[model samples]
Target: MDYSKDKLSSFLEVNYSALPMCCIQKAEVYMLDEPSSYLDVKQRLRAASLIRDMISSTTYVIVVEHDLAVLDYSSDFICCLYGVPGVYGVVTLPSGVREGFNMFLDGFIRTENMRFREDKLSFKVSEQIDEVVKRTGNFKYPSMTKTLYHSNSTMLAGFLKPDEEVEMPATTVSYKPQKISPKYESIVRHMLHEKIPNMYTYPHFKSDVMNPLMIDQLMDRKVQTLSGGELQRVALVLCLGKTASVYLVDEPSTYLVSEQRLHAAKVIKRFIMHAKKTAFVVEHDFIMATYLADRVIVFDGEPSVEATARRLL
Candidate 1:
């Protein structure tokens, strides 16, 4: 039951300045379910490091985690568990971490000759997200001046600090804010016209946004009367339908289910690439962010106050 300040901080959201710790005298095997659920990237790494250091020849640690990177860094073995929760689940025989992760990602354990999921999960690194930032450097977005910085200090767009003054190029732009307001009865289609004119006629949008978001099912509902998830989908489509050099979408996965979030990320990425446009997305859902981003930005500072851009990694 014992954990250090840094370790506890990784697991908790509260301030850690004068934190306390409680120690356990004796224990052996330990288990953690979704250990990295609440942590940011930095905190997740720290937690993984602490757990990694705790492992011994006699100590067997079983961590039930969803984040691939954190699991890869901490665990020595991998056991893929599938099937519906509160119903039935089957755990694969333990395998090496890499092999297990690969099996989990591939949706088939080759050694066991078993296939679980029909839909495979593939990971895309954040380099494409960085490339979006890099693409923005070709022109100047003088009004889009704020830098999304990191703790150690790296700029995503500009080569230098504000004093150094490197210009960013973005001739055309479209942005979807974190908060949105409803304006019409058929809010979904109405937003499309208001924010992304001709969205219904936008090529591939039906497949990319309309189909995945089930916009057809939602088109009849009033915008203000729509559910959170419905509204989010409409907002996302609005952001993607517009023709622009760069798209800045804030918190696209909010009020969505896990599966919907995944679909949203893929849709966002596909539309951006299809249109040959750049996008900067600010997302809180870690899994969706990792899947959608080409470059992940890390901001370090006070959480709400003085929360400044720190770096792009």
Candidate 2:
């Protein structure tokens, strides 16, 4: 138990001290149901590690975890289960780790020729994760004397780019707009050198943000002369270029076409997870928000007025 706790500490994002309490006897077979439940991405990995630590050739450890990343990292073999809840369940014979994960995601049993789901689900995590662990994290919010309006407003996120003019939402005005560039690459270069000097290299940024948002095709276009959709894409590229603990974005889908709106949601979701950062967004697009958010805070009162913040978990 002591070894388990110590080995898990490196991957644990949250403090967990219940390892000893959860187990009283040493058994040949141990089972845990959704141990990754209630844990963030980092903690989930640690939980997976702890479960793996419980295994010996003589002992079999089974973890019923829903998180694909945790499951993939934790198990050497898997039993994919398909069934109607509380009625009947079909569990396949154990398969090698990668093969089991591929089958689970594909939602098919090749041996039985069974298709549990009509649609296949696919997703990827990229290289943006390297920087998340390097930073210290704890949100420090402001304390103010006067009441502040909730409707779209601007704030100097005191930590990012020193005094860089951030044109917030709900405002028709622009502050400190930089020189228009005929080539989009110039704008990115200027922003990189002037603002986040140590930002990930251009190639890395392109892999994490540009390719998904399709910013590369606009590389030669002038910033001021770009169309609404193109400009939105540029803005997204710039916003996601820098690294931070908390990202505040307002109405990201503005001026974007239908397809671009969906792509923007994907960009936000991928960046948040890969970077392991928190994001607060002010968006009127309900569909986009629901698709991107894991937990959403609902305004339980009048719009642009008094409202209680309720979380839909």
Candidate 3:
């Protein structure tokens, strides 16, 4: 629960004394500096840190944001609150947690009345457990209920409730854009000095700006301005420019628009196919997967690897 600066202040004014002081340690309560504007990237980074803290700490942390009502009780269920696009549900899992915990997620898909059979170590739903098993493929370990919700009723039913649609405020600003520093410039210059001619130098070369050439120039000009896509592009350049034997990219196309995403795919394909380097990319884009990969590993029901040459024909 990462609260914006304004929301935190208001919350403190209203419930500072009322809040359980015994629970929250003085060192744990961090009030970040107010961002310059909503577009500040540092704010997201700061919020990420706070989120990490909350997840790691034993204390129950509550984050208050503008446009959100302060609940009386702490919620066990995590709600996204913000209606970020392409998300299936509000309380799926936090990013950091997902990255760490996804490996342990054997039977944790969305479901209700699910039971774990330790003898066979399989997941079983009351009604359609068998069907789900067929669809997901048989599991080696017992399937545990993905969602753990409590009901006051006598029957303890484990069901996944539809997430409430939360309308985020029009201007619940999260980040403020940062100014490029000398360190950013030096990084870009070092990249340009790599002697890659096709790598077009941009204006603001810093990872923050949208335009590629401008981003490079900005890196030189000490002006850091960029969107998410631009930052990914800059990162891609830096990664490819290096002389690594094995390159691994994990979902590089996240938070990108259609055209830019396609362009990024093309760039990645070009790099992997033509460049004298070995690269492994984990991407959801089917087209890019088919085009770029010599041997495609499809993890649908079971992980299957096939040669692209055989599959195409």
Candidate 4:
């Protein structure tokens, strides 16, 4: 840890500087927002451990995070915030971590008798018996368990389960990066019909992507007035509308509700398959990725510094 190292990204530098303050300063309360944003899986676990170790009997920590595993590891109690984005939000009373997560996933709070979402999200279980046997032919067992602990406290253990861009080549390529800051003042219809590149020539884009993602409903709304989820859907249509041999979709699940995400995944998957075109999707959602991808590539190391990707076989 050389804090002055030029190779460190802004995210890493911020973590290095801010985490020490949270640990050392005598503050009555500490707050962290998405501290695990750019960190890889291994680094996230280490950061969670550090946060857990820094807690004391006198201090209060309120963390705004989306990663369930990290939140589970780092929190004693969990408070779920639910509501329409850019609209009113309600926070539930603090409950045990497991219970809070269950309530969040189930889309209903039992004690308060409230339902935020229309559908519950459930994981699809898949077993690879041949792959499992092939990987574990020998008598030796692999590390299949995870342990969470504090420096001076008893350990808790559990058994668990489990973006990009660029150009080039013979055929043209189009990219939709993970984030889009809505700076436009034009309406969605204008943006769709004339604003985006090749919008006029994009055949059946509205039928293929827009209507499915429900972008037609927002056609009259200004781009700047659209919510995050609405903007994301518009972006997807823009990306898919372009005439190119290959399409790069980064984090298509961002800011989208569960139902919208599933629909987006379906639209993208169908478009690619039907058109017989090539698409590289960078997604964080398990169900979204599995549904859309034929083969998966795993990335390792730092995000922007010295990253590497290997395709799963």
Q: Which candidate number would show the highest TM-score if scored against the true structure?
A: 4
lDDT of 3: 0.35
Per-model C-alpha lDDT, please? 0.63, 0.56, 0.35, 0.66
Shift of residue 80 alpha carbon in model 1, Å: 15
Please give each candidate's TM-score: 0.54, 0.42, 0.31, 0.66
Per-candidate RMSD vs. true structure?
8.2, 18.4, 22.3, 11.0
Ranking by TM-score: 4, 1, 2, 3
Candidate 2 deviant stretches above 4 angstroms: 1-193, 196-200, 300-307
Model 2, span 1-313: residue lDDT tens: 3355445432111134454244435898887765643343344566677877788888887777555556678889988887643368888989998888777768788877888866565443343545334334432222221212122223434322212243333322221111113343354445445654554356666687778777656655446567655666666666676655556675675555434566688888888787767676655444455566665455444322233444333
Candidate 3 residue spans exceeding 4 A from truth: 1-224, 300-313
Residue 126, model 1: Cα distance from true site in angstroms: 7.0
| RMSD from true fold, candidate 3 | 22.3
CA shift of 285, model 3, Å: 2.5
Alpha-carbon shift of residue 44 in model 1 (angstroms): 9.7
RMSD of 1: 8.2
